[model samples]
Target: MMDASVDFSKEMEALTKDLVGIRSVNGTAGEREVAEFILRWLRSFPYFTTHPERAFAQEIPGDGLGRENVFAYVHGTKEAGTGPRKTLVWHGHIDTVGTEDFGALEPWANDPDALLEKLLAEPDLPDAVREDLATGDWMPGRGACDMKSGDAVFLVLLTYLSEHTDAFSGTIVLSLNCVEENEHTGILHGLDVLDELKEREGLEYLFAINNDYICPLYDGDPHRYLYAGAVGKLLPCVYIHGCETHVGQCFEGFDASVAAAEVVRRINYNTALCDGYRGEYTLPPSVLKLADLKPAYNVQTAQEAWTYFNYFVHAASVADILAVLKGIVKDSMDEIAGRIDAEAEKYAKLAQQPVVPPNFQPEVMSYDELVAAVREKRAAAEAKETALDDELAAMAHKLRAKGRDLREISLAIVRELVRELHPTRPLAILFFAAPYCPANTLRQEVAGEKKLYDQLESLVSSFGEETGEQYKILQFFPSLSDSSYLKIDDTPESVATLYQNLPGGKTVSPVPTERIRSLSIPAVDFGCYGKDAHKWTERMYKPYTFGVLPKLILKAVAEFL
Candidate 1:
C-alpha cells in the first residue's frame, strides 16, 4: 500500500519541471513528442500496459509534425462467474496552449529547482504574480496550470492506484490525448479510435472521468464548488466587405470596417436583443481585424475596397441557438451591406461593388456526450435550487422576529438566504446568459429547451459512436438577468396552481401552497487564460483547491458513474 502521508511536493515539483522543459506548446505541433515520452513512461510501469501499437497521432494542416495520443490500461480482478470487466476511463490531454517564444522558458534548465522551492514556500500567493520568480513568486513555463498539473495529478493518482489494484473495483483506462488547447482534434480523433477498439473488443465503460482542470488545493475558504457541467463552445467568424475610401472622403463609398463596427456595436450594446436569451445568450465584443484594406493603384483615391473580420466565441449555445445567432448576424450583415450598397450606388453605379456575403462558420463541442452533460447539469441545478428553497424557508422562520423591521428585514433575510442557497448561481448564470444564450428566439417559445439539448446530445453521441468520428455541438438557453435570488411569488392561490402542475402536468390531490422563488445568477469570475493556470509560482484560493474542486469532482463522478 502506498503511504497515505507520502509528500507529493517533491514529485509534483519534478513532474512540473519535466513538463515545462518539454516545450510542448500548442500550434507548433510539439505535443507529439511529449505524448510519445508520456507513453514510454507509462509502459515502463509493471502494472500498466500501453496499446499494442501507436494509439493515435496529432495532425496539423500543412505541418507534418507527428503528434499522438497515448493510452494505458490496468485490468481489475473479477469474480468467477462475472463476464467482461467494466472500465473507468481516466482521460487527460497532454497539449498546452503554445507560448509565443517556443524555446523561451525550457523547464528546470536555469535555477528551476530553486524556483520550485520558492514557490512551495509561498503556496498562498496571488495568481497574478505567483508565477513571476523575479518577485520570489512564479510558476514558470507554459502548460503548468492550463493543465500540466492536471496530467501530473492523474499520473500520481494512477500510479498509486495501480500499485494497490485490490482497492480498485474496475479496470482503468488512461487516455492522454493531444491538441486540446488548440482545436481538440487530437482528443476527438483519439475518442474515435477508442470507440473502434471498444467495438472490436466489445468493451463497456461505466463513465469517462476527464482530469482536465482538477486542482487539489486552493486559497482558504469555507465552501467549495464542483463543476457538474461545462458549457460547449461555438466560435464563428463574420466577414464584412465594403467599398473602402480615403478617410477624408468617407462620404463617397461605404467603409466596410465602419459598417462592420456598427454590427459589432449592435451585438454588444443592444441589450434587449442580445440579452433576450437571458442566462443563455452572451455576445461579447467581437475581435475586429482589418483583413483587406489597401491603397488602390498606389495612389490616394476615393474608390477603394476593404474587408472586416469579426471573430465571435459563443459558449453553451446549441444548434438552434447557433442558427438564431447566424440569422441575427445575417440580418445585421445584410442590413449594413444593403445600406452601404444603397449609399454607394447613389454616389457611383460601379458595375463591380464589394458585397457582404454572409459567411459564417461554427466551431462547436465535438461530441454529443458533452451536450447530454449540459442537460444533466441543468436538471441537477433545478433540483438543487428546489432543495435550497426548502432549507431557506426553514431558516427564515427562525429569524422572523430579531428586533428588525419585518418587511425590510425579510428582504435582506431572503437575499442572504438566497445567496447561501445558490452559491453557484453567478457562474452558472453567466455561462447560460452570456456565451451560451442564443440571440434570436420567437416570443412564443416555451419549455422543452432542455429536452432539445438532450436530444441533440443523444444524436451527436449516436453519430460519433456509429461513425467513429468526432462531432462538435452546442447547447443554448435563456438567462435570468437579475443578480439577486429569484423572487418567489407568494400569492396563495398562484402557489397552489404551481404545485398542482408538478410531475404529470395534472392537478394533484389537495394542491399544496408555497411561494415560487425566483432564481438569481451567482458571482464567480475566472480570469483570462495565462492568468490563472499553472506556473511554478501559481497559487489559488485554498478553498478552491481543497474544498470546491474535490467536492465537485467527487459529486460529478458519483453521479456520472
Candidate 2:
C-alpha cells in the first residue's frame, strides 16, 4: 500500500511546473521533444513499458514541421480464478496551442514553491484543499485544461495503482498522442498502430477512456461520469458577389462587403423559418465574418468584388435543416444580385458598370452520429431546466429569500450542467468558399425579419421557470467588421478574462440559492472552449477543475466502465 503521508499537492505542483516547462506549442516542431520527455517519464516506472516504434514522427501540411505521438502499456494480473476480463485504454494528447512567446516553457512562472506559498498563506486553507489559485476551479495553462493535466492525472492514477496493484480490476493501456490540436492525425495514426498490435497479439480492448479533458478531483463529488457520445462540427463558408469602383466615382452599383453585411443581418434577424427546435434538430450560427479585398485607391472601381463568410453549425442538425439554410442563402443572394444588376443597368445608362454573380458552398461534418448526439444534449438541457425550479424551491428555508437564493442556486446548477453537457458537442468544423465579385453590394428593398436577439429571448422565455431572470445572446465573429467591431481572440488568457467580464452587456442566468446544496463543487466564474480544436482558438478554464472534476470522475466510476 502507498503511504498516506505522500503529499499529492507537492507532486501535482511539480508535475504542473515540469509540464509547463516543456515547449510543446502547436504548429511548432517541439512535439517530438515533449513526446520524448513523456516517454522517459513513463519508462522510469517499473509497471509500464514503452511500445517500440510506436512513437511516430509526422510532418503536417503548411507548417512543414515534424510532430510525434507516444504509446505505452502495462499488463494486468488475472484474478485468482478468472482470466483477465478486458483491456482498458487511457488516451491523452500532448500538444498545446501556440503563443507568440514560444520560449515561455522554461522555468514556469507558476511554480510549486509559488503555489505552496500562496496556499499556506491563505487565511482559510481547508484541511482538504480542493482548489488551485492558479487555475481556480478550472485547469490552467495552455494545454493544462485541454489534456496535459489529463495526462498527468492519468500518470498519477496509474502510479498509484501500480503501488497498490490489487486495487485495479483489469488491464490498462496508455496512449499519448500529438496533433490533437491540429487534425487529430496523431490519434488516427496511434489507433492504426494499436490495431496492428492487436492483430499480432490476438488481443482486444473492452473499454477506452479518453482522458481528453478528464478532471478527477475538481469538486468533492464521488461520482465518476463516463462519456459514451460525441458531437461533430460543420463549418461552411459563404461567399458574396458585388462591384468594385474608385472611391471618388459616383458608384450606384453594389459593394461586396455591404452585400455580405446584409446577408449577415438577414441571418441574424430572420427567424420565422429558423426559430425553435425541429424534431431532434436545432441550428445555431457559431461564427460570422465579412471581409473585403481591394486596392485602397480603387475601392469603388466597377470591378468584380467578393467576400467570405463562415458559420459553425451544430452537429444535431439534419440534412434537411442544412438544405433549408442553404435555400435561405440562395434566395437572399438572388435578391441581392437582382438589385445589383438593376443598379448596374441604371448606372450603365449614365456611366460604365460591371456584372456580378453571387456564390456559396457547403462543408459538412464527417460523421452524422456526432450531430445526433449534440441534438440529444440540447433536449436533455431543456428537460433539466424544466425540472430544476421545483427541485430548488424544495431545499430553501425561511431564513433565505426564496427568489434570490433560488436564482443563485439554479445558476450554479445550470453552470455545472453546461460543463457536463458541452463535451457532448462536436469537435470542430471546416468551411470552404470562393470569391465571385468585387463590390458585392446587392441591396434590394426586402421586408426586415425579426432579429436573432429577439428570437433567442423568446426561446429562453419559453422556459417559464422564473421571471425577471435576464438572458442575452452573445455572437462571436472571427474578424472585426470595422475598428469598432469586437473580435474574438481565442487565447486561454483572453478567454478567461472575457468569461470573467461577460462583455457586450450580455446578462447570464443566475444560479438558484436552493440548488446550491446539490452542487458537487462551489460555483466560480469559468469559460468554455468547445471542440474548435484546430482553429488555434482552443482555451483552458482556470476554475472548472476544482468544482467539476471530482464529480465527473465519481459519476464515471459509478455509472460507466
Candidate 1 C-alpha lDDT tens digits along 479-517: 111100111112344333222211111111111111102
**Cα lDDT of model 2 by residue, 1-561, tens digit:** 324334344354356457755767765667777787877776666555434433333333233465666766554442432543345556667777664431332243223344444444555545433243333432334555555655665566555555555544444556677766634446544555556545554444543445554223234433222222122222333333344445665244445565555556556534343322112222344434455435465446323222223333212233443455556555555566566556656766666545432222212221122233444776866654344323323433221233332223322332233344353211211112211000100011212112323432344343222323222222211211110000111233422322222111012222121121121110010112222222222223332332233223322222212
How many residue pairs clash (N, CA or C atoms closer than 3 angstroms) in each of the candidate models, in the order given?
Answer: 60, 68
Off by over 4 Å in 2: 1-9, 49-63, 80-85, 100-140, 162-170, 214-228, 243-254, 268-283, 293-297, 300-318, 338-561
> C-alpha displacement of 325 in model 1, angstroms?
4.0
* Cα misplacement distance, residue 20 of candidate 1 (Å): 2.0
What is the model-wide C-alpha lDDT for candidate 1?
Answer: 0.40
Candidate 1 lDDT trough over 10 residues, lowest sum: 425-434
Reference-based TM-score of each model? 0.53, 0.51
Cα RMSD of predicted structure 2: 21.8
